[model samples]
Target: MLNFERLQILQKYYDYIQKKTGVRDYFLVGGALRDILLGIKEKLDDVDLTIAGEPIGLYAQMEKEAFSHFITEKFGTITLIPKEGVMQGIKYEITPFREESGYQDVRHPDDIRWTNSLLADAKRRDFRINAMYYRFLNIKKPVYEEKKVLDSTTLLKVLDREGFVFLENSGVLIVQNSSLIDQLLQNGQMDSDFLYYLLDIQHFAYCYGEEGEKTDSDGRFDLQIVIDPEYGIHSLINRKLETVGDPDIRFQEDALRLLRGLRFVNVINQKLLNNENKEQNADPLNKVRLFDFETETWKSIKKNHDLLKTIAKERIYQEIVKSFSEGNPFGLVALVDEAEMLPILFPALAKTKGYDQPIRYHPFDIYAHIILTLWHLQQINSNYLVRFAMLYHDVGKVGQYEQYGLNLTREEIRNILAGPLNHRFSSAELMKEDFRNLGFSNKEIEEIKRYINEHHTPGEILMGNSQNWTKRLRKLFSEVGYEKLQNLLDINIADRLGMYNPLQNSSDLTDSYYLKTLVDEIEQTEGQFKKSDLAITGADVMEHFDLKPGKLIGELLQVGFDWVLGDVKHRNVKKQILANIANYLKQKK
Candidate 1:
């Protein structure tokens, strides 16, 4: 199912190479081919080309013809930059068949050897589905249909003459023999009228791999797609992530493949969800379902989970982010826990696993509550920072209870742990160190720290009956800015919903809505909120106190702002602000 426009561009390049070198030994390989087989409609921009023989002669000729190319001689690969025609802004990395060995560092190969067989090259790849190859052939485009044909009797008669059958119920076409379609196309037995109906059938490609070969003649009748030496198409049709050969050997060769396997599961499940939501009328045979790891693959991943420690923290961080950001995040966490990689990744968060909370506030233990909180954030499409903050917001409770349990009864401890505490500040402190280890930027670390520290402020403001809410909120807005306050409110709502208690609907939900509406109303107004909005400046403080520009000047101004924060009318009166600063200086002296 190659895109018609992309197929034309590929055909042009194929023809150009065939004419230049007088040989046709190249094929399209890797992710581009995989995406085509999966019926993904996104534009296929990056493509890879592989040849069975040497690529130097072709690379030299293309370089001489003024094509921009970069070559890595040792790896036997060349990246060609096509800057003109239909292939503009596309890169084609052409590589000769090669085998790798000796992965001592667990990331790169120590040696590479050239081979002349496509099957040999396929055996050394990561997964079965990515080992296939595709070639563009010279033929007319096959007929394709987006809607069902009403005249099924005439179409079935034509297909029956060609030894094929059309299943009207599922809209799938099946060949009487596995090789019958290939033989007919090769021997020219398929007439134009018959070929039109043959290619136009929906989900016709599902019947392709059973006979040990797969073909895609959609955009090109001579489309010899999927040289699947490892039965990649079968694995794909079964919705399984399988290694090329021995799962253990593959994991031993590259430890990163374990996380990659998990990520593929996440990515495929996301695709399935997207299809269910967006493609209701899609053919059943073509719909992707929930993907899972083959039994052997899952076992190998668990057995080799320790190899992840050898990987760089940055790499592990990237894989974790990719796994959780786009797909079923709860599934990602559960899989990571099942593989026993959670303790190694985040030990502090892992310590909260068995720590139970009071049933009145949380039906689940601390760890499950954290996971549910993360899922709630996911339902609202929160960014990764907020999700990560929620994942560890309550982790400090473990240490908090342990340190204070010496003096309290069991019931008293549970009641104490059921509510928010200074543990949030402790969690923020611990998170800073973890962020430093995981290579988070300084700005990112500070933002997450604020999220953890201020997550409970909105709940306090909304649930409490206080007359100074305007002052507290305006001061909070001044301290962290407006955007961060808004995000903290989101975290508050998610945290409350993650709890399982009677007050969730009455106090929690109503309070959250009230807080949101209050903020929105305040945002719509043009009232002054912070020290910067005051009429008195730092210069006023320095001049009135006979002080130079230093920390004292800023401190005096802050004191002045605090004095007027209780009443908005006092903010614009410079005389009163200076008088307040004078009183603050007298008290300090």
Candidate 2:
């Protein structure tokens, strides 16, 4: 129910709509009903509602009001959002009622049938938990009706026996009957084997498991499936990265969640076991706890987190500015790392282990270094775009390895401790092929491959003359799209950690320096480069020389700039640097 203040705002819009079109009915439903039902024992912050009949303009009226609420139209369905935290600060959304066609495609409906019957409107929805209603009547005066919100008991009644619902909390509601599952199996509403296995009716799995594909979608859950008793969702969502190789199938059913299987186990296990421990205590859920030992699952999740590269540099910049302004950036790096689809979604991350850079400057191999690399990134910068990008920066190392490997000369490795640059393409191709098998979109796989290609040039690290630190910064910005700059430092740090090669008895002397250098850079490199702050302008160089500001002048300026960054002698005098460049150009001529 709206409080006095909300009632006034709601009544004002209600009257405006009624005056415009004599409409008599307006009420709430969907999430509001679910919340109200759930709120009997729990606190709810916002109310959601639906109007039985209303045109598009009603939404405009809601927006015109003084209070803050969201308004949008999704697939011709009008929606309104109210300010969050009125009661306890819950966000509210109001949407119009309309019929949806069956999910003919896995993503969204093909058509919508308009409706006046709100009950009929919600009936064809996917989940029983989502299909609920609450009604209201509009009058000259604010007439509030007191109706019984569906309590936990009432909701439990109509849920089909095979239907399953679990609360975010410990509430469990299941329909014991198999009629719906059986009907779905026959009529092809669902794959019988998945329903059976997923619901733990293991006995019935053989009935539908083998032929499920011929009886179902083009993609079959065939021989590749290796279900270890210990491998499950809890292990998947852990801080450790795990890759769900078949993301298409894992996500196709209920993909939004990282690991729904664990959520099910959480509720189902409570019903299955109560432990007082040795004396009969509630069992701390052995099955749920056991998955941590699943080596394969741990490998997958680790791969997944391993594969998630970074956000673009420009986006990182904005988030940092916002964090500074708001004083609470909300730890976006942790959020990105924690997202379920990240490893698979970002294939570059999925393949992070291909190259094992010798541990010279860091304690960990490339993979382990990336994790600690993230820790170093976080303490220095907090935004998602920056920290995450840093985490993902060397992600291309996977792609760069083969090219780096094939070109390796024993002479160079013994002396410089690095490999050649040609390997990124071959490595990228291998990874791209792998991604194709795993079902990632083509565009992303390509971008990630290119990212690996350009991100870490051995020349930059070793013999090739360097770009001015700022130009190198500009190069990364230009290549990956400037949106992710602030966090790209993560890649450099991770790469630095890759330089670490620990010895059996102690640390390598060279590695200690590399580690110290990387650790030093975390604090040294923050907010280090930008076009807005530079010693010499592009215009200044052009004006000083008899040169136009085209490629030649830019090249000459760049050389001078590098000398300064490399700390070459006489670098403080721009004239001396420019004179050195002019002499080098004359010798070439």
Candidate 3:
């Protein structure tokens, strides 16, 4: 059951609609109903409803009353929002019952025909568990006698007692068999009058099956009871999930669902495992089952793997974002690999799988190391940029390693390792195409590239002697802002943790203590190394030197700026800095 407060809110809307437009045949549908049946008490902020009649007319009437509403005639849907009522700012999407056809694109339907039948609309849904409805009904007004003289009362006498007593009752009523309500009412020993009232309405909460057959059992149970041991909705949800229609056809129609289904399975399995430790003899119905595709679904995914390539990158990106948002994105990524969808979705990532790495430092191969790095990122930070940076950080290694030969000179190896020709820059270059395809903004793409190119700089700085550490640190800080520097440091740490071996002493390449300490120092200084931190601006330089706003002033200012970085005390000595700049300019002249 939904929270009583939510039901009250739904009732309020139902009443408003009926009072304004005289329409009462509205059915609450989709995930809102599913959540209610699952006994979830969270707010059903996005309410989906199906109206038996014209939703556009209702929208128009709602608009006249100063309510906010919008209609999409393509799908025969209307979004009604109350501008000032109790539901203010809450969106309620009301669509006329619809039946669709011609799914040629395997996504949107080519034809949508509105219908008045709820069962027909229910049958058009994607999953049986999600194909359910809740009809809000007003309780019949109570009849009462004011005085004890009703036995011999005439019509006129009954009219005289009309002012004696008034009775009003309102609650949500669902359609179901009397026996079920009888069981609940009897079990709870509810009032006889309430039972009579429920019997009078003859509606109970029930879920629809794939074929639109109304069943007393919860639809979620039908799909999940096999893998989940508990009896209630939570168990039904927590257990393995299966599809309603042919799995292959479903995958072929919407390829994004394939990835989304896998993500659901990964998330649910993790939840189930967690629940097992916390719960004893847990009811399957009480378990929280997300979406789970069937075994055939997995098989269908493999068979129709090429179909994923045709799906929009935006759709694929949304699924990836959702999976990464979960606690165990690694599991989802693994499932994608197992299903062979990785090659279609992310070929670069797939290519990393078999690439070998130096075993002394990297316990796993290139691909395994990337996954481990991602896992470490999840533990340390939730920033998507950092996570994505780590994902493509070493993709260039695959191409770089292939160019290696035993006859290479020491100088050539040193140049390859230290120069822009290395994998870091190469990986950044390769990631541009993929990131653009994934709909990342140019700015975001640039940030990822910068992070990838500079991810190794922290370690490089740590390897340097203390005499040059400040200069290197200042240069690094000036290049990347404070926040991005922190992200780079996180990636560096994840990189080290990714290469750590449990059996052996930790590798120096993986050490992060010094890097963390440097981060602390940088934060304490608050980016004072940046050129912008110079006390004298370009304007000041121009004024003091009696020069125009030209490049020479910038060059002169840079000399002063370097002096400040070289010694912190020089920052406060503006007069001495200006005199030094003058002496240098005179020599240049």
Model 2: lDDT to the true structure: 0.39
Better of 1 and 2 by TM-score: 1
Query: Model 2: residues >4 Å from true position, as ranges?
Result: 1-49, 54-74, 79-94, 111-344, 351-382, 387-392, 398-408, 411-486, 492-552, 563-589
Best by lDDT: 1
Residue 412 deviation, candidate 1, in Å? 14
Model 1: lDDT of residue 13: 56
Off by more than 4 A, model 1: 1-26, 36-41, 44-49, 52-95, 141-224, 279-288, 408-421, 465-471, 479-482, 503-508, 520-534, 548-550, 560-589
Best TM-score among the predictions, by candidate number: 1
So what's the TM-score on candidate 3?
A: 0.72
For 60-179, candidate 2 gives per-residue lDDT tens digits of 544424234444645544433333223223344455556665443333556666555544454443323334432222111111132233332433332323243211111111222344
What are the per-model C-alpha RMSD values against the true structure? 7.6, 16.4, 11.8
TM-score of each: 0.74, 0.42, 0.72
What would the per-residue lDDT of candidate 3 be over residues 1-589, giving only the tens digit for each residue? 1221233434455556556444555666665555444334245567777765655665655433645766898887887676776667767778877777777777777888877655556556655445555543322332333223212123123223321111111122232223433342332223346534533442222222212212233321111100001111222333434444677766666666677677656654554455454677877866544445556756887787777777777887777776666536777777788888877766788888888887777877899998888888877777777788888899888877765655677787787877665999888987887878877779888988998998888877777786766666666676776677778888888887788776545445444666566656866865546676677788888888778977888799888876666555445377877877888888888
Lowest summed lDDT across 10 adjacent residues in model 1 is found at: 205-214
On TM-score, the stronger of 2 and 3 is 3
lDDT of each: 0.67, 0.39, 0.61
lDDT for model 1, on a 0 to 1 scale? 0.67
Q: Would you list the rank order by TM-score, best first?
A: 1, 3, 2
